[model samples]
Structure formats: structure tokens, C-alpha cells
Target chain A: MLDYPALAALAEIIRRGSFEAAAAALNVTPSAVSQRIKGLEERMGQVLIHRGPPARGTATGLRLMQHLDQVRLLEDTLDAALRPASGPATLRLAVNADSLATWFPPAMAALPVLYDLVLDDQDHARDGLRQGQVSAAISSDPEPVPGCDVLPLGAMRYLALATPDFLARHFPGGVTEPALRAAPAVIFNHKDGLQSRWVQKATGKRLHLPGHLIPASEPFARAVELGLGWGMIPEAMAAPRLRPLLPDLPLDVPLYWHVQRAMVPALTPLTAAIRKRAAADLRP
Target chain B: MLDYPALAALAEIIRRGSFEAAAAALNVTPSAVSQRIKGLEERMGQVLIHRGPPARGTATGLRLMQHLDQVRLLEDTLDAALRPASGPATLRLAVNADSLATWFPPAMAALPVLYDLVLDDQDHARDGLRQGQVSAAISSDPEPVPGCDVLPLGAMRYLALATPDFLARHFPGGVTEPALRAAPAVIFNHKDGLQSRWVQKATGKRLHLPGHLIPASEPFARAVELGLGWGMIPEAMAAPRLRPLLPDLPLDVPLYWHVQRAMVPALTPLTAAIRKRAAADLRP
Candidate 1:
């Protein structure tokens, strides 16, 4: 029996970072925001916010935020059921920058709703799904979350690429183990093994090479284009300026879409749209 | 006692995302990687990796990754002590996008090291430091972590701004709660409450407004520059194209640098450089 108004206030405070900001967003006085939170705390007998210049959620506050998210979803579902005129619902999703930058937006565009997108690596996105921070996720993980439905969305093809000048200077002998061993490579981050996998497959031997890592997707492609080092790029993201070194060396990374097992009817259209878009866009 | 080589192999596997890729990165065969991880697991008597199409670290493997980071730091310290000519050590840090886009890189440029940078929201950056996923973090947290020393880095001043056209169209009657409630605003993300804070300070009222959310820092600024909606922009990032709506309504967000209390001497220069640069660049 939590107070819905107070719970909304709690979520607003955590999201906006202060009672004052939450007050503004909710069209109430700062004192009102503080009072609601205090009332909620008194009822629960637990402190929800850690008082600071920019306030932070206590562990209890985090649990409350999650509850708010759940309540919002259920309320939206009920509203849709009661009125056909109810406007589109919001979807909070976890995605990667590369997907957001490339193919995912068009899929989402078909859905008529506000989107709260959290961008992170695919593995991290899966973690968010498991944590209930998001109702859905686009991830590299094929395994479904405990109460989620998983759909394979095909693969993003990455080609081993380098600028023309880099190829001429470093691999004049063509793609070989010795030459690759001596050349530097670009990576999304230390956790990226696409380049290493490509190198092993290309050279038929394991060889450690100096790595120049740039953590962002666009910068990584640009780093390769600028001749910082040879690396892999999604076929769709490969700048026109980049030329493939081993043109036939393509790595297909399979991606999956995971949706909550008990999804609301409002989201079915979105899932269909995503499935159709992914089928048309991703490499087989 | 753990085998250092096996531990290194385990870290590489987690970072690279696959045994084959780790093998290539370390100049060893896939069989060698498997053997090293197997031997390490047998000694520890716990599961390290969860096998799938791609492998992921079990919680134990994640702990091993943190241990790897610590061991690497200690080894670099020893190397520096034994030889003055040691190469620049790698420093893994989590930072806010605003700082990364502006003052922070120049601070790093003054240091002699390879960098592994993880960009996330400022509060989330602090969490990464707590999880031991990073060596240092630039955070909004004023208090230090249990074993960290905190330093004030002054404030990042942000101005609430809109294109002249947007201001004219949305607030022709001048800035007020009614107009604000009706007009759309841009936000870095749902979690970004900077705009809410500024609006309240400027309007002297609390009001919920429709929002246009873009998660990336550069894109969020660009959205403001493009007149998508009014939003707060860091003073340094405000392209000349953006004009301030309420010139006096500037928000000063105080920032802090949290460093491990037992920071090695090898990182002292970087810490000093960061402090000096922050002082020179940030508004006091």
C-alpha cells in the first residue's frame, strides 16, 4: 500500500537528481516534493534518499524507482484498455550506440511512442534487462532472461578494414601473420575481441599485436579511416573513405531482441515492426 | 597461489569476449587459453566463464577481471621502480561525456600513458569506481569512496539556451510557467535533470514540459543547436549557433575527482596534471 503520488515523486527525484528539480517537473513546490518523500519514508519506516547537494537514491530508493517503473507500465496498459484514444505509451529500452546509430532507430520510428533509450555495450544491456531497468533489450546474448522472450535478429557483418595507405605501407605483402604481428590495430575497447578473432582466422596462427583502442563506435571507424590502425567495421557503418584489406574477411555478430514474457498488448505492434525491420536490414 | 600467466589469460578472455580471440591477443593457441583458464579454475575450484556462442564471465570471472586490473597496476608500479625507462602505464578511468568532450582530454594529454576510457553519466561513473571497474572516476559525488580521496574540481557552468527562432516561437510572451509547460525541451536523457533545475530557477515555478531526449552528449548539444527544443548546454559546448534564453539563468554544477587513496607513484603525475588542468579550466 505505497502512495502512488509519493512513489512518482521518489522516481522524479532520482531521475532529476534533487527534490527541487523533481518539484519543478511535477509542478509542485520543493517543500511539497520533500513532504511527499518524507511521508512515504514515514510510512515505510525507511530512508529513501541520501541528502546531498545533488541527492542520490538509497538502496531503498532504488527499489522504489523500479516499482515506479512497473506501476507506470501497468497504468499505461489499463489506460489503453479503457480508451482507444489513449495516446502511445513510452518504452524504456537498453541498446548499444552502434545499433542506435545505424539500424535500430528506423525500427523504433515505426512505433508511435516516447522512448527512453539507455546506451551501453550489448552485454551490459543484457544486464540491464536482467535488473528490470528496461522492459526490453537488444543484446548479443542468445539466452533469454528468466522471464523474457528471445528472438534472433540476424547478424551485423563486420569487415576487416584499413585505409588504402595503411594497406600499402604495412601489408604490401598481403594479409599475413608476420605483417599483422608487426602492425597496430584499432579496437572498440579492451573487451573487444573481433579484431583478434579476425587476425587469428586470417593468419591461421595466434599473434599479439599492438592495439590502439577507441571506445566509441564512430571514433573507432574514423580511427581506422585515418590510418591509426587496421580494424573491423560494420558494413553499414564503414565510411566510404575506408577500403577493405581482406575484403572476404567478414565476421557476422549475431544479435537478439529480448522482450518481457508478459508484455502488454500495446507493445505487440512494436515487436512486429522490430522483427520485420531487423529481417530486412541485418546481414544473413 | 594463483598462476600469474593463467590469471592474465583469464582477463584477456573476458576482455576479448572469446577464447579464440584471447588466444590471438596473447599470441597463444586457443588450446593454450583453454588450458590456462582450466588450470586456474581447478586451482580456485569455481566456475569462471559461462560458455555460449560467445563466452561471458561468471561472477567469479568478473572478480578475476578486477584482480587482473589490480595485479597489472602493481606490476606497473614495480616496473617503474626497477627501471626509469619503463613505458607509460595504462590507466582505466570512467568520465562524464561533458568533461570528456571538453576539459578532461587535455588533462590526460599532459600525462604519459595509454588510456582506457569508459564514458557514462557522472553518477554512474562513481558507481563504476565503487565496483572497482575503473582506477579513477570524475563524478558528481562530493563524498569520497571508502578508500578514496576526493578533490573539488570547481563547477561546470551550464546556460539554459535555445535557438533565437525557438525562443521567439515558444516564449514570445517571455519566459513563464504557462509557456514552458506548453513548449518542448531537449534533455541529454531521462535521467538528466539539469534542464529541470534551470527551468525552476528561471521561472520560479515547478512545471512538467514535454521533452525531446537524446542520450549522447554531442547529439544533445547538437539538438539544442538545431532548435529541437530549449535545454541546458555546458558553457564550453555551446556552439556559437546557440543563443541563451535566460542569460542570467546559469546553473553551476560542482564536480569532484575521486582517486584511490593508495594511488601508486606512477599515477601521481597524472593526478597532479588532472588537478592543475581542472583548476585552470573550471569556473571557481
Candidate 2:
């Protein structure tokens, strides 16, 4: 059996980013925190943490932290009352930027636990689950990671949008391939393919256009509204400030909720809330 | 001399992320694009592009691309005519999220070149310029990177804020150390030290509080507004919906614009606009 106190020290060091901070939180001395980590490392025969001003967990340390969380969650399930000693449980989840900006807060509000959110492109969020960095992820890929459940949440519709002035300046000849080639685009990131996919759907060709790479969802929409470039904006997030370039060709990216089979019980409330929100906010 | 056409092919392939996409952009056949890259790789005696479905440039490849950009920008400076063949020059920069969501758009509008922005914590954005991935960066660090010019851009005032209901629920006894320990925080990310710094300033203690990690600027502010947790919000972004937890103990983080000394002429318009915007938006 592992030392629960020592494990708690290790988890706190990783979470708070220093032995001193963890010691403060645990109401112990920094030397005691160091000694606990030293003993734990000796027993494990592996260097678990990288000692930085802001400390970080090694792969082994992170796995151990995850184990500690699982044990605490299981214990909490057995107990009827909240444990003030442990404080609130921290649940790490990977979610897309658009979801966090739009319909996701209700789901986050529904949960009692503290959250460690990893924001990534919707298509790439599954990597967080696959790599064991997160217990659950909101992904566009319908496929489930091993020992995980895939719940098909409806699709997020994205429209090719830009300011009316941008359209008038760049597409005076109409939205042709040549006009698109000349116009700048506002891309989310290298991982995001929504704009390119929408273009392929609209023009039946893959054309590379020079543009701005604005990774944040709100700023990306604002970039288009400010007439910097045309971009793909989520239907739920598309405001009146931007006009659609191709109203007829909307891209519906189907999303899924991927949760570890073991964590589903602990995450039931959040899952239920996500389902409720998605139903209202997404296209069926 | 290096083959400029082959170099253009390399830049296009890296920018577009595939040989076929590069071909589409350059108005050439995919095989011709492939041949050009093959010849360039042979001449350099190193692997340049990692051939994924979405291609990526190796470090040496990226350096060569940067050289190409510098040459083009220099030529554009000399000629004073926009070159339709090369398209608008793409300038890669690193910016803090808060600035991007608030005052940075006006500066972006003043420039004619396309932007590729890497959003990072203000404290860490300088790493992008140091690593040669970006020509310029907006950072809180006053120290300039080697061969870079640092322009002091004033400070962003941050207030410790939460919704009124959150303060009532968590701090019923008042904002004591114990109350702070019990109340949840809304942290921007693990790298963000504003909350910890503010706590130290207000209470003369570093309290490790459980919280939500919302990385995006707008969503992070929204999280506090939604009563998920309290966070250090930018003065420019603090909405009327959220109340200040400590109105007197505001944290002012000084920001600087770091640009490559060699690229100052190319970036003058952007620098002037950034200075003007910062003068209006940031605290003196």
C-alpha cells in the first residue's frame, strides 16, 4: 500500500507548483514536504517531480496523482458527507474553445468539484484523454479511447462568415475561387480545419490562402467582424456583428463526450448537464 | 546562391501544410512542388518538412522560412509597391491573451501584413522571440532578449474580482486568510501568477486555493462573472457584473513590446499603433 499522506504531499506540490506552497497548504514545513517526496521517490525508484521554482509533475508523478484522485473519489462515493480535509476534488477535462465560450458554463456550474480545463481544437481534444492527461474530453471525433464511453452529443454548426465591408472589398466579382484566393482568412490554429473544410464544401477545391492565425474563439470571431479576414464561426457563437459568406453551406461538426468508464459514476451530474446544454445549443 | 523558387516552394509547403495545398496556392502541379522540396532538401543536406497530412517545418526549415520573410519585407520596404505574386507578408508574433481580447485589434488593423499570433502568458511570451519562432512579442518582462528592442508599454491594472454572491457565500466572515483558503479561485492557467501575487500583496501570505483553470481571456473573465470562482481580472475587461474583492489592492503588471532589432523598420507602423493603443488603454 502507498503512503496516503506522502501521496497527498506529492499531489499538492504538483497542483500548487512548489514544495513551499504545498507545505503551507498542508500546514507542514517545507522540509517535511521535501522529506515525504524523498521517501516516496525512494520507494518508487523513480524521479517523480521536476524541482523548479514552479514545480511540475513527471509522467510517473502525474499518474500517481491521478491514482490518488481516483482513490479519493471512490472514498467520497462511499461516504455521504463532504470531507473538508480533502477540500473539493479537482477534475481535469479537455474541452474545445467554442464550447467553453458558449454552452459549456452551465455544465461547469452544475459540478461541485474544482476544474482543470485543457482547451484545444475540438478535433484534437481526444489526445488529452488518450494521453491520460484528462479523465474526460469533449471531442469532435466519435471514436472512444480504450476503456472509455462515447456519448454522441449533437453537431455544432459553423458558418463561413466575414464583415459586409470585407465581402464588398474582396468579393466584388462574387465569392469565386479567384476572389477567395486574394482574400485573407482568420484561422483558429494549425489544428483547426473548419475554415478549409468549409471552403472545400463551398468551392470543391483546396485553396491555400494567406491569413491571420487568431487561436481564441471570441477574438477569431471579432477578427472577422473587424474585417481582418473571413473565418468559420460557430452557429451558437455567431453574433450579428458578422455576416455569412455562404449561408447555404454550413459545416456541422458532430461532437462526442468521451469519459473514462471508471470515472462515469463520479461524472454523472456533469454528463447529464452537458447533455441538457448540448440539446439546446447544438443542431440535431 | 539558394534557388529562390525552391525556397518559395518550401515556405508555401510549410505555410499551407501539404504539398497538394502548396501546389493549389502556387498554381503548380503537386509533383512539381514535391520535386522542388526534394531538390532543396538535397542542397541543404537536412530534412526540412515533416510530411504529415498537415506538414510542419523542422527548426532549420523554419529558420530558412524566416530568412525568406526578412528578405521579402526588406524588398517591400525598398520598392514601396505591394507584390501580388508573393501575397501579403505573414508576420509571426507572440501576444498575451488579455491584450488580444481588448486593445490589440486596433494595432492589427493599422498593419497591412497578415499576422500569425501565438497567445501565451505575458510573462512567457518572450520565449517565442528567444526561440526564433516569432519576430516580436508582447511581454510583461522589462528585460529585452539579445538583439531585441524592448519598448515599455505601461501597465495593465488587475483587480481581484468575483460576483457579489460568491463573496457573500464564501467570505461571510470577511476576507481573512481562512476565508481565502476556503473560497475557490478562477486561475488563468498554471503559468499565471497573478492570483498568487495578488494574494501575497493583499494578505502577505501565499494561500493555495482550489480553482478552475480557464485559459482564454474572455472565458476566464466570464467564469468569474458566472460565479465559478474569483480571479484577477484586467481593469480594461472587468465588467459591471462582477464586484471587486479588494478594491484598494489592485495589481499593476508592466508590459513591454519586444521586437527584433533588425526588423524594427518593417514593424514601425505596428509599434506606433501599439504605443498609441497602450497609452489610451493601460494605466499610467
User: Where does model 1 sit among the CAPRI classes?
Assistant: incorrect
Reference contacts recovered by each candidate, as fractions?
A: 0.26, 0.65
Pairs with steric clashes in candidate 1: A191-B15
User: What fraction of the native interface does candidate 2 get right in terms of contacts?
Assistant: 0.65
Best by DockQ: 2
Give Cα distance to truth, residue B207, candidate 2, Å: 2.2
Q: Give the per-residue Cα lDDT of candidate 2 at A136.
A: 88
Cα lDDT of model 1 by residue, B1-284, tens digit: 66877877786676666898788767788999999999888988998888654677776776566566665566666644574442334466777767765677656645444456667776666666676666778876787787677889989889988889989998999888778876667777656778778877887765666675568666567656656678888898888877887767789988888776655454677778878878988888
The TM-score measured for candidate 1 stands at 0.65
In candidate 2 the C-alpha lDDT for residue B254 amounts to 91
**Candidate 1 Cα deviation (angstroms), residue A199:** 2.8
Clashes of 2: 0
